[model samples]
Target chain A: MSEHLPQAVVALDVGGTAVKSLVVDRDGVLHRASTPTRASDGPEQSFAVVLQAVEAALAAVPPTHTAVGVGLAVPGTVDENRGVCVHSENLGWTDLPVRDLVAARTGLPVGFGHDVRAGGLAEWRLGAGRGAEDLAYLSVGTGIAAALVLGGRPVVAGGYVGEVGHGGTTDGDPCACGGRGCPETFASAAAIGRRYTRLTGTPVDGARGVLDRTLQGDRTAELVWAEAVDGLGVLVSDIVRVTGASRVVVGGGLVHAGDALLDPLREHVRRRLTVHRLPEIVPAVLGGTAGAWGSVLLGWRAAGRGDAATVERYAELHRARVTS
Target chain B: MSEHLPQAVVALDVGGTAVKSLVVDRDGVLHRASTPTRASDGPEQSFAVVLQAVEAALAAVPPTHTAVGVGLAVPGTVDENRGVCVHSENLGWTDLPVRDLVAARTGLPVGFGHDVRAGGLAEWRLGAGRGAEDLAYLSVGTGIAAALVLGGRPVVAGGYVGEVGHGGTTDGDPCACGGRGCPETFASAAAIGRRYTRLTGTPVDGARGVLDRTLQGDRTAELVWAEAVDGLGVLVSDIVRVTGASRVVVGGGLVHAGDALLDPLREHVRRRLTVHRLPEIVPAVLGGTAGAWGSVLLGWRAAGRGDAATVERYAELHRARVTS
Candidate 1:
């Protein structure tokens, strides 16, 4: 271990269930750690967990890897310009100066952003959307939303843009967002599982179980899955028409289903389009680590060291890590 | 015209039936003219008409005004970068090098763009959307489309963006774009008129007739209008959610109905929105002349003379002319 090595950064993706932390150097990831968020304990305890997670990541940094900055990707409505977490329905955070608090504890500059946006940034810069000037990253996890990247820059419209989840898709089921027929109500991972259970009076693990049941020729499961796919198609078609994004990278738990999800979706959207050019729908290559990698990129950007070549290097390293 | 005077520009708004041209100077519109497009005569004849319209506008420049550039706004799928009118179902233009031809004819630089985008630029820079970084210009004319301006720059995704008209809305009647349930099938001025006619076996002039019938207590007209308003509301609500646009400027023939169109439409969209901030919905002030004024602005921008102050000067002069 030598101090002469190029500086690295600490990255954290804070979720309600767990915090994924990483020490990312120019060569590759130097260390990784995952810790419980303990979000239900209260906002104070959750903040403490965030701080501890960062500390542990920093402690894992090799002597040869000097930490330059820290990046945190949290799930919620965040005001990135002000370094404040405006609100998080999941983590129960409100107006928390997480960036300032983290910076004070670590004595390093902190780049704070929304989790979905961070993941989108990573995908746009390093994964499926690489080289695309206009792209969208649609994450269909517990909830459905999108990260819009236009003109080679991620659109952060006061952190309020990319709420496609709540955009109405039908006039049937009411959404948790207090709207009927929202894309989230039909296509979200949580929604798919809930709908399947509600329709058949049986419990399921998640979207994966529903997808599996559909593949096994369960009529109820097939109907629920088809509904989810149709809803997603409508949402994607709207995004493509509105944004003219050439590429749409699908991520989150639903993407793991691979062609089972993409083939039908591509056909559905293609049929729906009339004047708009058909966008290339693809899977996110970064998997669960995308948010953490996005945090690393954000940290580098915050440190003013995020050149295109540097980003390429990190992306190549991450790809190699996943393959190996 | 004296060469020493401040340079002005020739602007034209080319539509299916007519072309509106203007000689715009520092003091505002120095001269205005209108002529038939003769678009039924085929693409070559229509192109000749465009040239004649430019010549007519250039000829109207006052002795103190020196014409420096020309700008043309045309309906259809325009490739602004390549200066080609990709396709225009209305004007019958396909892959026409409008910019190059106009430039060659006028022996001056030309600025060419989509008609809706030109109107949107005018609204964003000089009309209702002034001072807002994120806004949408929704034109509910023969067809419904939007021009999205984000972060003070119009989102021109290869001229394919803002095709909200073709995005499905209800899965009912087939749209002219070969899609069913598209916004254009339910919300466009043409759709409103056609739906009203089909519902009551009465041929009406246009959307105005439908609105008039609705005000006269016709249940059929009221239902048609209500459906159009609802479709438009869903479209606008989706736009607001996806783009976080702070203001939505409604233009085109439909806006002439004023509060008749705005009041209920606003309420419908407001009710649909859940978490997103409600954007102020207002009518476009520039009216039919917006496209010509926008062409003028584009010409100035192309001539490397466009700045905020220059735009403000032109806008002030235009406002004075309207007031007078």
Candidate 2:
């Protein structure tokens, strides 16, 4: 009788810019919160930022439900099984036992993993990659990364599996990852904004602004956009060849470019792969909430309520919230 | 008491150049044979060639042993699960049900797979990729291809998984596969031989001959050899970045170059991958026998005598043949 009505969980996606946290139950998210992540201020400050967001989300849980567990999604090389950050360039962390620390502090079970991998899991299980036995989700934000889902599960090769942004040796200039000729240097959403700004000395909103200008026939915007498309084509073509992923889900802020981005990118990949079975390149369906929703899965997993079947139930519940 | 004799299986690796076959029991290979493959003469001739090799191998089986099954390894998009060749450019075949047809003709059960994939399976199970959970086997002969083994098993992906030769968008002229900038145009052993002869108008044995001349300070040989290494470096770097394979097993004819090939190839791969985990690039231990041995595995599988444990038992038997 004292089993505490119904239980919910707190999920946090710790990105470089902000910590997006949510309180969710089997019925879907009831509340959400965001907090600044002082990532450059080091691991301690970032940890604090995460804790603040978690606490706030927990407090916002519906009065009928009690928060039971926590799901933490972070950046960098993570050992999901051990719930440890092997290395995170953004958080300045190494060998940090995030699950144990958060579990101890919150007195709740914890599930932890790489942020991109988490988002990919959500996409694979219930979004764009639902029916795919193998899928590659390419997230093209300020930086590019991929989450490989093979055999209906994410391929987490000790967090080294999907660093295609830094892995690709395609067209480009010097990159922040200490490599030259990286595809993302010329293709990422941020790259479009930066290159366009530098070349034209004209300020635009972001990749979105550049796309708008391109639609309006801005020469600099067209060049920047065209180069981005070509670089992505090389990256995706290489990815299809190497991984044999038949379905490719392109995500992140740049997906807003829609047909303007996908059409030319598809042309580039098709032109390059003459003898290969072409992969289905499509926009990611989950958008920005992927990581946060993926966090819900992690939270449910930590609470011993997650599996393929449970994922369906949550998908049903959350999908109702989304579409309705 | 009447079950007196051990059973052997006939295995055939049908390639564009030849059909190499062997007879093997639980202990190891006992006999081998090869016949020219009339591959360009069309599918029927190729099938006849394969049958001749199989018959020759079965006839060579030890007098005390009974032949039980057959294993066929072919190129192109093979549905190993269905034992059908979806397409083979070399054999000029499409949807050719090799296993079923051979089984009907020989009145025996049969197993089948892609030749390069079978070779990679052998390498992963008992050779260069012995203990690697994920490994990439790159075979460079007249052409180039890769067999990817992930999570201790080969990734079949409906046989579209590893076509890195024509997959890479790199520096090159036009390719035979109707694509521009394919890595194989420069990196394959045939490419090395063809380019050197085209440039110097001097007769050479092959890539091996070019290497010998390069060692003797032949300038044209040096240029050709350098380009091959550079092309391979780009391909391998992209492969490493995209697949996250921590070990690369290089096989086929060019591996004979030893340090001359590996050293410069390693330098190129390193120069390209600035931030990825450097893979252990090594030579394949099996040399040319990998496909035949892998066919032995398929034969055993068809005979209901294969599994992870059976793979171990066969490895033990074959290792004796290899070493002693």
Candidate 3:
């Protein structure tokens, strides 16, 4: 752990409930920080809390600094080149240039990116898809969305690529995107917990609780899980047809169900596809730190200091390891 | 023409019925030489015939000697990097190393490319899509397929990007791609003629004949034409949903129907799309010679003499025009 201190970059992952902060540098080492988002207090107040967190993290930084860049991974539609969070329903943000605001406050050259896309970048570069060129990252948390990486580059699709949540379904269920029958309405982690609790007389508070009951043969949990996995399969199939991705990385709050959810999804996708090669569906390796690590990488790349900073940190890490 | 006698690329476009050959310099100036394909005689027989035609054209080149490459454009899934014709369903080719064969035979580097994608490249570089970045080239011919160009690079999704013909439909007749209710079942030129002939009992020969009858107020022809337009509209809508491409260039055989198809398609797409921005649908400027010209340009780029070739040809073309 002491060996990881020298080669660190700042990563800030903004979520509705909490803002996760971390320092992950060249060697893939991690030092984490968390603060309440209080999204109801809005972008300005929440942004202040984020700034305070960054200050605290910066205080721990060692002296041999080359340059600093922040990766602010936010939800919703982001105009990445402009560094603006266009719209996030959960954060209630609309046309906010969060990148400029953060940079002005922190005096750090910041790297702004979409949350799901950033998580995918982390997994692809440092985790499950380390060598895979074509992969999809599906995050089934409070809300559902995906980040598709094709030929080693994330498919941005004119800022509308991975809206798997809003890939309007043939089913009849209302989605918060103001659409009827969207994939997120059934496949999301929140949906899994809510749907199971509603179907059965006995309530399960969270996905983990539902998973425990499911292992004990709860009929409601089993049904709800099936529906969620079915939705996931459908969404995955659509992406497969379009992108021809060779690998899929599954993560988020619901992934705690593990092999129970993954095994069935793998079977369904394989059954549905007739023409294309069936992609390997695997669990994402970065776990919870994916977004934060991804943010720092994005920041580094954005600043055009990638090679220089990486080499410097690599040398520092080697020196530290030798000394210790 | 006399002053620039030696400055031309032998552009050979291999199709099902005929092989269209021409000498085109960097300027759009063309000298034509065409012959029957005789594809049923098989690849070796067709190759012998084509070799004679190419030799005849080269012999006609009067002394001024600047031909650097042979540009061959064929209807097929071309492995552009390897310069191989992987498979062309219409041409009955499989694993033909066309570029190497042509280079060895002609003593010049060969630039081979897929006909439709080459046509799209021509349109994008010098025709309707000259100024646009994210555009689509929809070639609605005997078969229906589209080439997607994003950021001036064609989206070849692992060699299967433009297979738009098999795009399944909601309620339609069966298709040849082993899929029930595909877009090509009703939207293709052949389909248009078939539907018109079946409905009216008029025994119209082809798309042109059907269009002529429709113009004469034949009820069944009009209905078939309308349905074809609607099918095109559905395909266009699907492209928008998946790609978010804002500019589309339409070409191929059916497009010769002109405003009869375009006006109706424009109206249908506008009426159907409630949320997303309606893309500007327009016609391609490069007519029959798009593929050949684009292939020549590709050859010029490959040889590292593109700029010099363009300048020399521009000067020669200007001189020719002045002398004429």
- Listed in order, the DockQ scores are 0.59, 0.55, 0.20
**Model 1 CAPRI quality:** medium
- Which structure among the candidates has the greatest lDDT? 1
Task: Give the CA lDDT, 0 to 100, for residue A252 in model 2.
Answer: 87
Task: Kindly list the per-residue Cα lDDT of model 2 for residues A56-172, writing each as its tens digit.
Answer: 887898788877789989988887878899888888888999999989888999989888888888887767777897789999998888888765557766567778888445445
Stretches off by above 4 angstroms in model 2 are: A1-7, A55-63, A66-69, A104-109, A167-172, A302-304, A314-324, B1-4, B66-69, B103-109, B170-172, B307-310, B313-324
DockQ for model 3 equals: 0.20
| Candidate 3 collision pairs | none
Give the per-residue lDDT of model 1 (tens digit) for B229-261. Answer: 988898888888888888999999999999999
lDDT of 1 at A14: 94
Off by over 4 Å in 3: A1-7, A62-67, A134-144, A167-174, A185-240, A244-283, A303-305, A308-324, B1-6, B46-62, B167-174, B195-234, B257-278, B307-324
CA lDDT, candidate 3, residue A92? 80
Give per-residue lDDT, candidate 3, residue B188. 88
Q: Return the candidate ranking by lDDT, descending.
A: 1, 2, 3
Q: Could you estimate the TM-score for every candidate?
A: 0.95, 0.93, 0.80
